[model samples]
Target chain A: MSTDTVETIRTTVPVGAQYAPGSLLDWSEALVPGDIVLDERVAPNAPWSAVVRAGDVLTIVDVGGNQSADCLMFNAHDTSERYSVPDTLTWQGNAYVREGTVLRSGLGRPLMTVVGNEIDRQDTIGGACSKESNTLRYGHHTAYQHGCRENFLAEASRHGLTSRDLVSNLNWFMNVPVEADGALGIVDGLSAPGRRVAIRADMDVLVIVSNCPQMNNPCNEFNPTPLRMIVTRNEDTVR
Target chain B: MVGARDTASVLAARADARAQGSNVSDWMPYLPAASSPFAPEGVDPSALVWAETVAPGGYTHKVVARGTRLRLEDVTGDACAHVLVFNALEPWERLNVADTQKIPWQAYLGAGHPLLSGEGRVLATVVADTSAHHDAFCGTSSDEWNVVKYGDAAPQGPSPSGRALLTLAGVKHGLTPRDLPPSVSFFQGVRVEDDGALAWQGSAGPGTYVDLVAEMPLIVLVANVPHPLDPRTDYVVGPLRVHAWRGDPSGPADEHYSASPERERAYLNTTDYLEARGL
Candidate 1:
């Protein structure tokens, strides 16, 4: 749990400088399902991108529900310092994460804080998907299922990370409950058709994700959807 | 006929019992009885192997895993099990609608019944349950999964079709993105639908459960990977005897019991190979 006394302010009030719809451009066309979009104003992955200063709000919107977005965050200055899920859970004292949980780093430091949430926050416990796995679980015959692994590999290419960098991830919009018997369950989306979660970068962080495109189960009801991103400048910056 | 008052009274008692968590079977789905915790011999502790051979568009047994094998008899004949394995370790991997489409498996498997994965791996096999000689390629759906080829023209009861079974498997396995995998169905037959329209046909039945063997150790991982490719056609692996640990002074159980030097040497080399790879 963080004890740092930081004044909180709402950017929605007083009409903060908004990244208008048209003004905002996706590097990829139309932000379709299974695509990754990063705002240029913030730090990018690898070569250890510069730290995003305090009060920077990052918004990731699931254009639809039941779509999973894997996320990972790291300290900009310290390479080893990374996000800690256990600490985040303890900090909130609640298993479910919503608008207001400040994600702590592995070093017990604040990395990013959930500023605003338009949808039900997802699971941090579930990890990402891959291919060799695709073959092993399903029979060898249906081996070519395109999934999040391909997405991460594609995205990681830009950052110079091969398979090594792929580690545990946060399945945003995914809901997993730990049962009394210590069993884990993947529940349906509590998020509506269209939902979004916003986080303020405490520092320049490296985030990676694989917009999950799995059709095997009802997590997405076999229909992959899209997502949008918006970065808003603090209201004080405008006036 | 039991009068309306009697029926209503019974229903009320059943509901009250359920609300209090008392076990009752009046409203239970297709099963002889509520699953019991006790395991019978020749069966695995957490799994049920089906005996009857099912075809495309066919379904049997609502719940079958925890300690019994519901062997499909392949009643009508050869069929395919277009299955999807989920994660009992992490239930969130159970299934995803958008993911299926985004990955384009929805289109590829829409009528073809592609298997899903947690962490991206094929989790189950879809064995045919109906007789239409359905193409080995299409995927299955929910609402539009209307064409069911039954043995006889009886009342069209809503049974758990291949699609429903896939969903149930996802729930049972606690599937998630991490446990994800591509899937294949057994006794496959069906034409691919360009627009997702399914054409039913003849299929295998009774005495078929894919006879899937677990390649992994953990229940969570085991639950997600579907059954193996048919042994008759595909390359088959082992009926391996696993020991509690490596380097046991007794060696592997089989070798220890048989006192076979050859088996002991095989175990030693395998251990060395694994250690060399840092696995």
Candidate 2:
């Protein structure tokens, strides 16, 4: 006689179609590999937004090159089990994340796996945005601007997730070239319009995204462009 | 089960350190600053550089160096550079903004400022300043903090400019959300509308960079750029290099000065103090 309300529901989205603009999706139906979503170029440094469920495909299409998409990720099941770039790299044993790399959770579990790549995928080592970043990086006057954190919390709230669920994420479509002296250089992007990478979920995952509106950084070349996502499920699987 | 085991071990280690007052510094081995795997392909192998570029999202990499100056270049001008620092030997150690703000280190991060460790050691020194000044009051913010500050508001996404420097520093130092302290962002590009209207403007030019000289054997993790957003489903990102770097010529020994446990503890205590005050 547990009085706790355990709500189990299923919502389905078609593949190759645009995600309804400004719509909040249920965690049960959002994140799936092969699902293509799109974001028309946002103003520079605007908050990026998105959501995903377990076992879904997620893709970001760089309609134009040099658009810095400031992004973030978190676990739906447990916020503490956030994304760890070092662990992911150590686990993968490679610096560049391409097809077939598994995204590890904070606890070092496989949250999802990268299954496809249209363009050379970007790095996850870089994290998402926040107001403080906005202010310090930009100027004191820009502190009040909207950012990825706000988008994540907003979508996560619908699914009973909270700040604790917020985790570090991967930066897709960005290009940063490293040098031998251990110095990092933000370079132009390798992604182009219609190019994409796909991810397959490993478990029931709650995925959140912020369409990076950052103008600073060469990853996007300061031009925040729109992106598209497409989600598809395996045939014969009723979701 | 294996993941759980690792989590348990990490939790146990954290708890044990807290209860026994066991210094994590003693357990941590000093590593070369340029020794991280996060270094991108094709750089001077001898130099321990942290990041070559920062992807738009939250990403990190490590660079090991000794006596080498680390540069965070805004390949494009007006790039907001959110940078953090730490002692590589004790990955848990980090820079204390409050202590950093004290006296010589305040308002600007340049030559002569001691980069504090989680254990309160002088990990590095700000040897140069290419930008206007080093930001002491602001550090990288967690998603949770951002939400608390702004309700249902979107963030200014990721900064590709030199944003990766922060990520690389975090990863190299083994820092987690709990370890996040005040960071400094350089070469930001945003347009504020008259009467509070906002416009996105490209602020940085190609090749605007910041340089930092390592004081200890510290790992430099930088996620110069932010991750891309999937408008519908949140994507689980794979490992990608935000930027690449070459190690400094001087070598790891030249960059770091050895320290005692007492000094390490003082450094650690300072970071703790700052966190307690929400700096």
Q: Over all chains combined, what TM-score does candidate 2 have?
A: 0.42
Q: Going through the candidates in order, state the TM-score of chain A alone for each one.
A: 0.69, 0.69
**Which tens-of-lDDT digit does each residue in B1-279 have in candidate 1?**
245323356777676557766554321222222232222335543343222212233333222221121222222244344443333333334333223322222222322232333333222222223332322222332222222222221113332333334444444444322233223333333332222223333334433223322111123211111122122322111111110111112224432212322223323432343346552
C-alpha TM-score for every candidate: 0.39, 0.42
CAPRI band of model 2? incorrect
Question: In candidate 1, which residue ranges exceed 4 Å CA deviation?
Answer: A1-53, A235-239, B1-279
Docking verdict class for candidate 1? incorrect
Residues B96-161, candidate 2: write the lDDT tens digits: 443333212133444444555423335555544454433332233334322333322133443222
User: What's the number of clashes in each of the models?
Assistant: 141, 171
Q: How displaced is residue A2 in candidate 1, in Å?
A: 44
Tens digits of per-residue lDDT for model 2, A56-87? 66655555554545454556555555555434
| lDDT by candidate, in order shown | 0.40, 0.46
